[model samples]
Target: EDDVIWTVLDRVEISDDYTVIFHWKAPFPYGKAMIAISSLINYPYHIYGKWAEKVDPTVPVEEEPNKSLVASLKEFKPPRPITTGPFIFKTATTSELLLVKNPNYWAADTIENWETWFDGVLCRPHMADYNARLNNIMAGEVDLSFITVPKETVDSILTVPGMRFVAPPTASFFDLDFNYDKYPCNILEFRKALAYAIDRRAVQEVAAYYGFPIDKYATGLPKTFEEEWLSPEFLATLETYEYNPQKAEKILRGIGWSRGPDGNWRDAAGKQIKLAITTWGPYQDWVLAADNISHQLTKFGFPTELRPMPPELFYDAWDRGDFHLRVWYVGFWSTLSPWSGYQSTFGWDLTRPESLSWKGRRGLNPKDAVWAAFLVDRLGRAWKPEEQKLIVEKLAELHNKNVPLIPFVQKREYMFQLDGKRVTGWPDPDDPVWDGVTAQGPQCYTTLLVKGILKPVR
Candidate 1:
C-alpha cells in the first residue's frame, strides 16, 4: 500500500522465456531510466519464488501474514546464498554484514568481467555517535566511512600516513523546510521575506565540509541540473532571493509586522513573532549551519533561536511538525533524478503522506500550484527528450516561483577519505560508478572490488 514511488508496477509481461517488459499505467517520462533503479528486477526470483505462493492469506489478515516472503531471505544462513551478482551475501550480524566473491559466479575468472581483488567484503555500520565512529577509524577498527567526517579533523587526517580524502557536493541537499501549515511562515510574502533575509552562500561555506561548493546555492534543483532542466525564462523572471535585510524588513512591513520597542517584530495584535531554527546533531556541520541561519535572521531584526537536538529527539519533533524552522536533507541522491525529489517533497499523493499531509512535518498541502504543474508534466504521453525538456521547464518555473524548499548545496561530488594502507584505489571522479557516497565507502568500491581495480594494501 505504501507505493511511495508510484511508477513501479504490479504487472509485468514476459515476451519470451528469457525476455520480459514492464508496463506502467502512465507515460512516466522518467520511468525507463529509473525503472531499474526505483524497482528491483534483477534478483533471482526463482529460489525465493516458492515463498510467494506459500504465503497463506487465510492467516488472520489483521495481523501480519505470520510468514512473509522476505522471511525466507532472512532464514538463509552464512556462506550459502542465492544470488545472481558477482558476490554472495555471506554473513550478517548486529555490527556487520559480509559479502564474499562467488566461485560459481556466472562470469568466471576466465571472463573479463570476472576479475576481482578481495575474496570477501566486511561492512560495519557506523555508530550513531559520529565521534565513536571516528575513534574506531583512528584505532584501526574500521577501514573506511563514506560519511562526512568531523570537518575540523579532516586537515589533520589528510596528513596522516597512507590517508586520502575526497570531498564534493554529493547528492545530499541541505535546506530549511518551512511548515506552510503554520502561522506567519504559511504566508507567501512572509516566506519570501525569510528567503530574502538569509544568505545561503554564507551558510554553505560554514556547513559544507568541502573547501568550495560544486554549484551555486540553489532554490530548488541542484546546480548540476540547472542548465539542462531549469527554464531560462524562470531564472530571468523569478525572485533570486539575494540577501538584503532592508528588502526583507520591507516585505515584513507590508505583511503588517511592526517593530516593537525591543527591536523585535510584532504582529498587528502586538504579539511578538519569534522564529527558532532547529537542526539535528551528532554532526557538527548541521549544528553550525543552523547557527549560521539563526545569526543571519537575527540581523534582519527577527529574533531566532538555534535548537540542536540529538537525532532521535530531532526526528520525533520533526515528524510532529513542532519546529518553527527546520534544517535537514530533502532527499536527493546521486542515483535519483530531480523529478523524484520534487514529487516526494510536494506531490499530492495519499501514498506519500510525508510530503504534504497537514498532520505531517513538511506542512505543505495540495493547494500548491507546483503539484498541478508536476501532474501536467507527467501527463505528456510523448517519450522524446524534447517533449521531456518542455515538461521539466514548466515544472521548474512553478517550483522556482513558489519557493517551497530552499537549498544551499546539491551535487554528486561527494568523497570519503580512506587509509590507503588498509585498502587502496578508490574510484576517481571519472569512474563510471553511478552510486554516490554510501556506507562501506562509496558504492563504487563494491564495483571496483569485483573488477579487481581496488585491493587490500597488505
Candidate 2:
C-alpha cells in the first residue's frame, strides 16, 4: 500500500499494445524519474489480469477493490516465472542461478545494436565469506562478481591476469541511527553528545575502506550534492558535530548526567546508562563498525554493547524499533535530487497529515511530523528546480538541528570484479561511460550487454 508509485499515480491508461499513459494525481516533478529508476515488478497481465480487472485503479487501499486485489495477488501464483528481458531464468539452486538469452525479445531484430551476444549468464550467490568469493575471482572461475572487494584484498585481486575492477560511485551510505522513542536516545542533548563523541573518520576507516567520512555539517545530503544544492550561507549555518570528547562530557553534565565511580555515566535518576547497537551479523563491515562504536561509547563513560543478529531478526528488530541504536544505510535514490535524500533521512513521506502515527519505525516528534508532511506536500507540488531548492534548504536545516541519525560514511566507490579473459568489450577504466556507472545508475557491463557491446573473447 506504501508503494511510491501510488503516491503520484491517479490511474494508468493503456493506449495501445506498445504504449501506456500515466495520469498523475498532480503535477509531480519527479514522476518520470521515479518510474524510470524504481525497481517495481512488472507482473504479467495475462495471468493476473482477471483479478486486476476487478479493482478500481482510482480507489484507496483501505477501500474496496484494492484490498480485494491484494488478497487475490497473495493467493495467485503463476505456473512459471515469465520475463521479457534479454535473459530468461532457466534454473536455480541454493548456490547459483542460470539465465539464458531470450530469443523472443521484442527489440531483437527491430532495433539497431540490440542483439544479445552471450548465450547465457550464470549468477553465484553472495557468499558470506569474503575470502571464498575472492578466491573464485582470482582463480578465474567467476566471470563477474557484484560483491564489493574488501580494501585489504584489492591489491591481491588486481594481480589476477585480465582482472578488471570497476569502482562506481554509490548513492547510499552507512549511518548510526538513534531509536528516537527509546530512553537516552530520546533526549536531544544526549543524542548531540553522542554525535560529538564518536569519530566519523575512524568509523569510515574501519568499516568502509572505499567510503568517505560524511561531511562534518551532516546536512542529511551527501557531500557531492552540497555545492550544487546548498547555498554557501546555508551550509555555514549547519553544526559541524566534530569529534570532541570534552564537549560530549560537558553536554552530558549539563543534562544532569554525571560520571559514576566506575567511569560510567549515571542519569539524573541515578541509573547507569547502558546502550546496545544491533547490526546484521552477515554484514561484516556493519558488525565491525558497531563493535568499534560500542568500544568508543563505552570508553566515553557509557556502557555499550554490540548485538549482531541474523539478517531476518535484525530487519524485524529494526522495523519494530526494538534496539537503542543500529548501523544502517541512509541515502537518496538514483537521481541527483535532494528530495529522495531528505525522504530517506527523515522519512517525511511516511507521515500522512490526517494520521497521528508515522508509517515507519523512526518515531518523529509531533512538530517535525507536521513539518515533514508539509514539506512532502510542497515538494510534490513544486516542479521548478528553484522552487524545490527552497524546500530542500529547510529540510537540511531541520536535519542538522535534530540529529535523527548520524551518517558516518558515504560510499564513494563500489568495487565489482569483471574477468576480461572470458568477456571482451567491457568498458575501459578511462571510458567516459564509467562516470555514469553509479550504484543506482546504468551499470557499465549491463549497458554494454544491452547495446550489443559485450562478446565472448573465445
Candidate 3:
C-alpha cells in the first residue's frame, strides 16, 4: 500500500461485477479527487490472478512468499500490452510507437456519434531534444507537441502560418531543496542567510522567463491556492525573505562566520564553506536556474558550484540525500487541494517508518514533526472547506517559519503547440475545455478526442 492511499483508505470492497466502493479510514475530503487522478491501474484478473492465488492471506506476503509477490510481478513481462481504452497498441520501436483505434470500444454505442476521427496516433521519441521537437513543429511534421519554448521565441514560432500556441496554467513549481543532514545547510541560520542572498527574481528573469517568481512568503502551497485558502491577515504574518545580500552577510557574521582573504566564507572553525547545486541536465531551464543560483551564492562569499547530472543520477542523488543542495520540482500533480501539497512537502506522517526512512531523513525538528502529524490528521478529518482551511493555515505557518525548501518560481503556463492545418477542432484560448487541461487537471487531449471535439481535416 502506498503511503498516500494507506493514510486515508481503510479497505476497498467490490460490491458487484461492475461496481467498486471505497471505505475511508477518516473523513478524507479529497477522496474523490484522489481517485480521479490516481495512477493505480486495474490489472486483468485472468493473467494476474494466478499469482494472487499463491499468496497466503493470513501471513504477510513479504515473509511467506520468499521470492516476494512484488518481485514476481516486476519480473513478469506480458507478451504484449493490454488496455481497455479507445486505442490499442499496434507496434512499437526505438523511434516510434503506433496505436490504432479500438473498434470494439465499450463506449462506442453508448454515446451518440461516438467515433475517433483519426485512424491512429503515431508517437515519435525526441529523446529530450527540444530543438529537434521545435524544428518538427515549425516544419509542420508534427501535428501536436507540448514542448517548453523559451519566452523570446514565442513571437517567432507564431510567425509559422498554421501553428498555434496554447499556454495554460499549471500547478508545477521549481524549488531549491537543502539536504538537512549535511553541514552548513543543516544550520537554520545558514539556510536563512542563503535564502536571503539568492535572488529569486533574477532566476525568474534569466532562466524562468515563462514562469513567475514564487511569493516572497511562500508557504509550500502553489501560488494558485494561496489566495483561495489563506486570508490576508494570516498571509501578512509570514516573513518575506526578500533579496538582501547585506542581511545575509549580517546573519552569517552573527553566527561567527567571517570572509577569508580569498573572498570565501569561513566557518567558526575556519573551514571554507563550499557547496554545490545538483540539477538535471536535460532540462534547459533547470540548468540555467541552478547555474544562476550557484553564481549568486559564489559571489556572496559561499563558493558554490553547479553540478549538472543526467536524470537518473540526479534522482538517485535526491533519493539518497547525497548533495548539499539541489533543484527540486514540487507539485500536487492533478489535484488542486492544499492537502496534497502539504503531504509532498512534509512527507505526510513522520510516524510511518517508511516515510521516515525515505523523506524524514531530512532531520525535521521534533516540534515540527508533531505539528505536521497534527495537520495531516486534522486535514483528513475535516469535512468542511472552512474547517480544512483552518488546519491548512497552521501548516502554512509552520512552513513559513522554517525554510524547509526555498521555492524559486511557479510555472504559470504550459506551452502546447499544434498544426492548425492538420487538425481543425483545437480548443481556443478562451475555451472552457482549457480549465480541464492543466497540470492539475485531466488529460486535455484525451478528453477532447473522446468527446468528438477534435476532428482531422477531411
Candidate 4:
C-alpha cells in the first residue's frame, strides 16, 4: 500500500523568524479521519563558521617552462578506458605513491593475484640517488628500479641471482656541437679541422663508459623495423666530414694560423689559436675526451680551455651562441616520420628563428637549407604523388652528400632498480617508437603506459 506523492506548491516570506509558509492543494492529515499532523521546520540562514578565509587560490595554472627536460603530461588528453595496463594509480603523496590492482582488470586470471603473487604495489619516483636504489635491489629490499645505473654496476648486477638486464635501443648522440654562429667555428674549414683533430671512436669507447655505440653519422634517416622515411642521399652528405687529423692541421695552417715561438699557433691578427671548450657537469668520459682533444690540438699550436658547468648554465650559453666548443647529446626524432628527425637536426630547424638567436647569429648553411626546404615542402602537405617522387630524389641527394647532420654515437638506455614488491610492471626492453630520432613522443612514464608494459600489482 505504498504510493509516491507528487505535488506543486507555492510559499511566501513573512518574517525573520517565521521565514515563510507553504500551502498545498491537498492536505494529508485533514481528511476528516483522526490523524496526526507532521510539520518540517525550515531555516532562513545557512550556518557557517567564517567560511575558511580564501587564501589566494594557488597561482593560476601556467604553461610549462621552455627548453626543459621535465614536461607536463596535461596536454596529452589520451583516450579512455585510459591505458589497458596492469596497474592503476591509487594514491600519490609527495614522498611516495601507492598502486593497486584494477578490480575490473582483464588479466587477473592468467597472472594470479593474491593466490600466488603479490597483492599490491608502492612506488616512489625521483629517488634522489641512483646507486642507493641499486643497492636496495641487490640487498633484496627492492624488486625493480628504473635508474640509469653505470655500466660497472650493471656488470656487477648481472652476476646476482634472480635478476636480469634488459638493454633497449636508445636515441642518444654524443658529439661536438659546432657553434656555426660563433668565431673560428664560423669558418667551415675550422669546423672541419676540429672534427678531424679528435678521434671519435676513442671518445665513444672511453667517454661513454661503453654505454653506447659509435654511430659515425647520427641521423634518423636509416630504415629499421620500428621506423622509416629517410632518403639515402641525406645520409651521405655527413660522411664527407670524417676524421682526418693531418688534414685538420693543414686546414688550420691554411687559415693563416701559424705555429709560434710558444709552441702554439697564432692567427694573422695575432689571436692565439685557442678554443673555449665547454661541458655540462662532471661527465668524466667527455672530460677525458676534451682533455685528449685539447692535447692533440696543442700539437697544432691550438690550446683549448675546458669549461665544465651545470646543464642550466651550459644550455644558457649555448643557446646564446656564446660557446667556443661544447659537447652535448642530441635526441633527434621526427613527428611526421622517423626520417624527419634527421632533417630537423641538420636542415631548416637548425636555422629556424626559434632555434637561433635573431641578434645576428646565422645557423645552417644554404646547402643544408635547400634540403630542409624540400623536406618541409614535402611534409607540409599530405602525401601527393608528385611530392613523393620529389621527396625520394631530394633525400637521396642529401644522403649521398651527408648534408644534414654529423652523427657520432648512439646512447644506451639504462634503468635504476627498485624493490620487487614495489615494482610490479615495467616496459620490455625494446626500441622506442618516439626515440629522439624516430618520433616526437612523450616521456618515459607515458610511453610505458601506452605500450602496455606497466602492469599493476595484483
TM-score to true structure, per model: 0.79, 0.90, 0.92, 0.59
Positional deviation of 429 in candidate 3, in angstroms?
Answer: 1.2
Q: Give the CA lDDT, 0 to 100, for residue 294 in model 4.
A: 59
Q: For candidate 1, lDDT tens digit of each residue in 1-458? A: 24444444445666987988777666555566455444444445565556555655556424456445445546865346556666778788877889887778776664344443456667776535677666656655555565554456776565556565655444457777776666766666777777777887788777775633323323456665665566666567655677776887898888688898878888777888878778877666778878998998787677888889987988887767677788876554412555656555544544564444443423334555446435543733446777766665665556656666667755333344465666776766454453433212333555566566666775
Number of backbone collisions per candidate: 1, 0, 0, 39
Return whichever of 1 and 2 wins on TM-score.
Answer: 2
Q: How does candidate 1 fare on TM-score?
A: 0.79
User: Against the true structure, what is every candidate's RMSD?
Assistant: 4.8, 2.9, 2.5, 18.7
Global lDDT of model 4: 0.49
- Local accuracy of candidate 3 as per-residue lDDT tens digits, 236-333: 88888889889989999999999999989999999999998999887777788899999998999878878999889988987776779998877776
Please list the C-alpha lDDT of all candidates, in the order they appear.
0.62, 0.74, 0.76, 0.49
Identify the candidate with maximal TM-score. Answer: 3
Q: List residue ranges in candidate 3 displaced over 4 A.
A: 65-67, 110-116, 352-363, 439-442
Best by lDDT: 3
Worst 10 residues of 1 by lDDT: 434-443
Order the candidates by lDDT, highest first. 3, 2, 1, 4
Residue 37 of model 1, lDDT score: 47
Residue 335 lDDT in candidate 3: 51
- Per-residue accuracy of model 2 over 26-47 as CA lDDT, tens digit each: 8878777777676355777888
